[model samples]
Target: MDNIDQIVDARGLACPMPIVKLSQAMTGMEVGQTVEVTATDHSFVPDIEAWCRKTGHQLIEVNEAEEEIKAYVKKTK
Candidate 1:
């Protein structure tokens, strides 16, 4: 999407690491700011969905390419 405030490249990282790095990156962001995360883990979709639900963040979109899964999340909390 447009106007993304931060991007977390979690490619090559496994389950928890991708989420962990995403969380860390989101920690410094302000409310309404958007963070785009690119990960290679197949579990990132569900993991990030659950995380967004639990943390009150808005999961804007998720895109899967040949080698990566990209997720756009907006900080709401």
Candidate 2:
């Protein structure tokens, strides 16, 4: 997890909540930093992907378990 700057737990929240929290957590990040967002919402896979695509961030990886989903996002530009 070298170069990972922050971790955001967005479990229990839905929709825009996770995105909002991720946005806040990334507010102070310098360009090229990474954020790991762990979510309990299964749909977060596409949600986060769309968010990253729209925001110009990079989705490093996506890992999903039976009860949770984890997205590794990096600020690209």
Candidate 3:
């Protein structure tokens, strides 16, 4: 997909929504592909990171805006 990574805006989504979308997005990606997921659920920050760790995906970057968080993750599938 080159630089065309998937973007999942989980911005008002609940706990598992963000992570579930991320998992779904990674399904068709290459091993080194990336996905950008944005969420407004602050409590999901650590949860998502921990999920990534357990799944072996790489968490590229995390940016916190005024009311939301942006997480960049690479699919290691």
Candidate with best TM-score: 1
What ranges in model 3 sit over 4 Å off? 1-4
Clashes of 2: 0
> For residues 1-77, could you state the per-residue lDDT of candidate 1 as single tens digits?
89899999999998799999989998999999999999999899889999999998999999988889999999998
Give the winner by lDDT: 1
Tell me how far the alpha carbon of residue 45 in candidate 3 is from the true structure, in angstroms, after superposition: 0.8
Q: What RMSD does each model have against the real structure?
A: 0.7, 1.0, 2.3
Model 2 per-residue lDDT at 30: 86
lDDT of 2 at 6: 93
What is the alpha-carbon lDDT for the whole of candidate 2? 0.90
**Candidate lDDT values, in order:** 0.93, 0.90, 0.84
In model 3, where is the ten-residue run with the lowest total lDDT?
1-10
* Per-residue C-alpha lDDT of model 2 across residues 1-77, encoded as one tens digit per residue: 56778999999898879899999988988889999999998889899989998998999999999999989999876
Per residue, candidate 3 scores C-alpha lDDT tens digits across 1-77 of 23648889898999778888888888978898888889999977897789889999998888878899988889876
TM per prediction: 0.95, 0.92, 0.89
- lDDT for model 3 comes to 0.84
How many clashes show up per model?
A: 0, 0, 0
Worst 10-residue lDDT window for candidate 2 reads: 1-10
Positional deviation of residue 34's Cα in model 2 after best superposition, in angstroms: 0.5
